[model samples]
Target: MRRTSSISLTCLVLASATLGPALTAQSAAVTPDMVQTGSDIPAKWEEPHPGYDYEKREVMIPMRDGVKLHTVVIVPKGAKGLPILLERTPYNASGFSTDRPHMRDAVWSAQRDWADDGYIIVTQDIRGKYGSEGDYVMTRPPIGPLNPTKTDDTTDAWDTIDWLVKNIPESNGRVGMIGSSYDGWTVTMALLGPHPALKVAAPESPMIDGWMGDDWFHYGAFRQVNLDYFTEQSSQRAAGSQVPRPGSDDYQDFLDAVSAGHWAEANGFKQLPWWNRLSAHPAYDAFWQLQALDKLVVQKPASIPTVWLQGLWDQEDMYGAVHTWEALKAAGHASNNHLVMGPWYHSQVNRSAETLGPLKWKGDTAADFRRTILIPFFNTYLKDRKAAESLPAALIYNATENHWDKFADWPGVDEKHLTPMYLQSEFGLALNKPQAGEDSYLSDPAKPVPYLAPPVEADGGKRWQTWLVQDQRPVATRTDVLSYQTPVLDRAVSLEGAPFADLFVKTTGTDADFVVKIIDVYPPNDAEQPEMGGYQLPISLDIFRGRYRKSFPNPEAIPAGAVEEYRFRLPTVNYVFKPGHRIMVQIQSSLFPLYDRNPQTYVDNIFFAKPEDFRSATMTVEHNPQAASSVLLPIVSGK
Candidate 1:
């Protein structure tokens, strides 16, 4: 228990609340008429939940194309046949409102503490987004046998769980699916086809793999700040396209004037056409795997009971939770699965409990992940109960000794493949050790690095995991950024699993863009702790897009410096490098606008580039050991 004291012991249960004795018997007196409810109310109504007794309604289910979606259940007051926690979303699932009281301090909501802890929550709105209907197919729509107007997303979540287990009343037929990030891709697209009252799922940080290359696109590039600010703060009225809401202080000062790029009189594309149809798809073809969504985690749909939440400093859907946990462990379903990964980010359980970024954990890692790993993982498999069956199918948290360990698997058989730490002094990085003479850089797809992350002003803050560690500390203080260091740790260095980067290079130009960064410096502490000024200390980072390395399905054109060998996997970390921390690696090309401008001229389609193929490309970094450029940590040891 020492990842810096597991963020001060999960910040004292991050605002402890099982709904605190039902919000200490109500009345903290908030009234917009206590959130309005009449239409002759009754459908087993009761509402007024600050503490408990909630039971609200609004059902209308259908959808197999017969369309009728709109759901919002709730339930708490003496609920008996429980077990139905679900949460499908295109966002507004009517704020999961039961007269809005149970926010006993939320950072990730789905009715805090599952309606006074008895379950039966429900909250839907999938088909065509708001109010639900028909046309809103973004993520996984094309089912098996490869495309033929397939109709999927698990057949609209198996006709909305067959009309909520035949009209919901105290439904204990059992069902469980949690949310976070497109409600974690609608519980990984409603745990695929298997709906016999589902069983359990916990998708957190998912967009499963839709906006391509993992959330709004990255490796195939074009995630220009979360698909241009989530295509202008979503609400295309599910694509029929409607507008008039824009004023969040005039869209935060037009994203502070396009986060300073001056994108032609910024209206960020007059309310984002899903970021202009994702710059009309760039590479990893089949139109981003027909809008990915990890093809619904390799269709394991059913034997449920899973729990996956990732955030190694998340920075938005960390490769859709590491490629949907490696396609649900290659479809064998890893004995009912459970994975966690911490160092939080991307709404790290509602940021700001003093600090998460400049590393200050000692408490509330999102209320101890909703009471020690989501209420004992829904009281051990949707209330059949055993309360975490001897726990630890996996429970990581480990950021720089931020604690929470236990692991039976999920990258923990005590990995230790460690070796490549090359990049000798142009400034940093050493392992096979040598201080040579080689450091070239001139990337420029028309002057990049404006993907934006300087103290976050917004316009989807150019997504290199939202300027992670301020985009590798300005590409390690650029000279065309090439710092790589590793000579500061004598004893402690625990980096529990998954991170690869191998490159042997040469590129003067025919096509070039190699960016790799993995840092976590922190040793020079204090500058201000007024509640930790400028949160970002244990320093975690991630970025990779070297022309999708070798085949994310064909892309080549690097003839200039000519001498290539690229491989990148980086992004999946559990970090722990104490004893005065320092483990950096930064190599650059450009993370600009969170990746888009390649144009080194392989152009079959880089979204029709022609700003004179955005010139500038001299980039190399081979610091020879027989050209073995490095970074491949897994590292864990002994029992």
Candidate 2:
């Protein structure tokens, strides 16, 4: 019998060479041979390659409600039963074939690696999508221990894995789950059920939360960019249609123009049925909770060896990954988990950038991640293969130095360098708290500064005309963005974890969004490089939106022109602010499309709001010793 063989391995290789390319995991390539044409495939199949033959067949596994879900099983040929590797995605299961053009182009990530490793890989489209029978719900259902009414994605996953083990052939029984993005979420869902066969999971860039907290929502704000873009793309895919091919250049230019002012432009938003359905049930209502991954995990947590892959600059899903990591740790699941964070964005890992900022890494970090780290992790945990545990439990790529840091935990051991860096106007950012001084700014929501970290066009073309970090220096210069910094550190100040920026403030309107950003100011330099070197470290940096200052649970309209105080937590980081470099934080009212424009009206739910509901609001910042306005840096002491 013949299975899909690599184009290169075929006797008529030169003719079929067009079908294969030199990818990192070339040996793990998915080339199918002996394409079977029948309604149902037999239990066993033979292959020309004695060492490896695979049987592919469709099977309907029963769910909790007796709903049979369609699944595809890819069993390794000739080998004894091995641990099962599971993947559940909304994407079609039939497309899981390794030899497909899309998979070869790096578009499909999970299937290739595991299939190549002699593992029995199974891919299933979640119930209600594609081949599965059930009404497809976009996000997971929410029912956690803390809040017990949720019936979510985890429940569905539990049903699937429970069925797979009992029926699949050549089953050594152990199971491991791996996938990125939505597939990542599926893995997390599976972990929640804690199957005896489940040994490990790797969830990369998962959508962990749904409310105005993560992914689907922001700080009391919906994610306009993602909601509009994802709904359109997902709905199309769900309908068995492809993302419209890149149209004419003129049409592409139109998309670019529409994306320019996405926050303000009503015409740019995609109007998909799913988006409408999602908007109707806004707030952290039970509807959204059913879809919240963190809440579900906290209630029905997964007890398995887990690895989380997070991208610091991921335009989408960064909050979900980071917040999920923190939540799991807080729930006391820290010891069994590890994190691998890079300076890449959503799809940036495909090519893998060596230099994120001014720093350069040692190798093809993505490939290194796959070959050295990921493979070993699954091999050891799932296959019970003995291997060195020397690899750091956590691997983080520092953007500033562009190097990898290995540690036993997400937040490395404390190096105890807690120093209060005050925001002084004269010296920019003072290392010590200021004696007595005040900085003032007016935050106009209508004229809020655009988020400049990454530029992505939901409709299609890139927004080159708008702000990227390069164009953001001007915005950072605005009075609206209250900038405070500590003078260049005399010695390197290493920050290993989350930092808090407690602010004192007064607002002239009912509400205001306080956006805090921490920047690692680079050393002064004068070099004429193609990428622009005059501004050594003029990056817009990290930003966190602040609207529901008091609580995400209940947000009220601030009395017009009233004074209020809030604490903003900057995203976690581990970096050494080198000598002569400054640590800076900029506070503003809005992060634009990165977060939906706050309506300024202290409304209970804002997801289903309209353009008319948005109101202009004013913001102010106060600095006083009584306010004790300061940033608490989680500096690692005895490094």
Candidate 3:
């Protein structure tokens, strides 16, 4: 959210967390006597405000190495023995609750529940950026071979907590952490070697592995559509640092530029250190592997309670929370690990989660989560001093059923539930693999398929953010995209767990990128919501860059006109195909601006490929006994 914080600097009190001297008021107005004879400047200038619901202190807490981190501490008036709520964000510390006229107009809506209950709320700028002093490194790797300094996010968090417990007298020495996205990443770092006072953590939509399925890339195709994010984030310390917005559509901008490398350079993205390093390390090498939180956490896991929050349609950082939850369980640290997935796009739980694109939920899911799930979680660990046995291992939102489900353990794939849905001749989808059939489509790089409909807005806009839930009907009619679907079902088909795309294909070009989507086709005559009738809702989708099919680190060219298997897993879902609805599978070579257009022709790097490399390639999908192509679904119980 490009926040609309209206906190006036003049009204806020400035002091250290150790109760430094506070600024009293606005500078004494220039009197007539001072105007006539320039008076000597006062030895001390002060800015202070009194009688607020909470005492605001802006302190610079020192790290072990003597570098100070800027922190904002809010102690409610008369609060005693209250647990501390800490959120450390690269997005400015003070901006969290800036412009509040009263205590009720607190931080973001997500934290309102906690704010209402008494607690000493604390926010801090990580290490660099804003009031904190130090040079900034984007997602700095933990201290080891990657980071040699005595500080990383882990050390900073540990130092910050140690200081707060000792300095803040109102607190009961118990601390809990909460944040989303990169801020959520900091919470992950804190868990690596948690401080004694850090009792609980809730990381929402966290960035686990950038190279796998986070904001940066999906399997190896860089998410060039959000290139502006690199410019804004790495260019400056202040959050929401904006650049010029193009009045034209994002599709046209990317189309003209041809490649992400060119687009970034044209838009002045070269100056940032992170962009340069990211461009250089296009593969999952040491740089990215070093930063993958999932791998790192397994080696040194945390035992304290941590609730992994995920959005069902999170446009950004979707892989993190779910993947972490699974990883923790596999590593045998499952007891303290909990998972909760909501019907939301990136960070939607922080706001109203009533609807996403064409789909509307029965209730306000966000408020419900904050109240029922999040509040109870923090309360149990921070205050109750008891085991969180009441909470289930997983609390997931059934998007199809439109309700929540709590299980003692996460859902698993069973052979009985696994069904192979095949793509056969005549654009048909069936349960059994077909014999000797093939479908061909011409995928032209010049006229790549758009992720969303025409007049697509900038990536910064709402349309781009919520495009995950947009109807898929717009592109189903295109010649480049191949559609295969089962006939309208007379019975409901519920799905759970990850759907695997096993495609056997031969491309005229040596290299290609395949985009697969699993959709739910709405019936024509819907009485409840006529507007949603005939809508094609995408339940699961993802892209796989062909060159990296065999090896993520090493890229190889595909042999022309030879059948090769492209196997990859799509995002898992807990959805149901209603009795009247149809299940569809669409396959195409490109997903346009969302993912960088792959030069069907093989080259050293698609980013630096010449214009001649962008040629039209015909892709033939094979479905026969020898080369079967199908989507493997994990069927949950249904009629």
Better of 2 and 3 by lDDT: 3
Compared with the true structure, all predictions reach lDDT values of: 0.62, 0.62, 0.85
- TM for every model, in the order presented, reads 0.35, 0.77, 0.91
Q: Report model 1's TM-score to 2 decimal places.
A: 0.35
Predicted candidate 1 versus true structure: per-residue lDDT over 504-527, tens digit per residue: 778766666666777666555535
What does the lDDT come to for candidate 3? 0.85
RMSD to native, candidate 2: 13.1
Superior candidate under TM-score, 1 versus 3: 3
Which of the predicted structures, 1 or 3, would earn the higher lDDT when compared with the native?
Answer: 3
Q: What is the C-alpha RMSD of each candidate to the true structure, in Å?
A: 26.8, 13.1, 11.3
Model 1, global lDDT: 0.62
TM-score of 3: 0.91
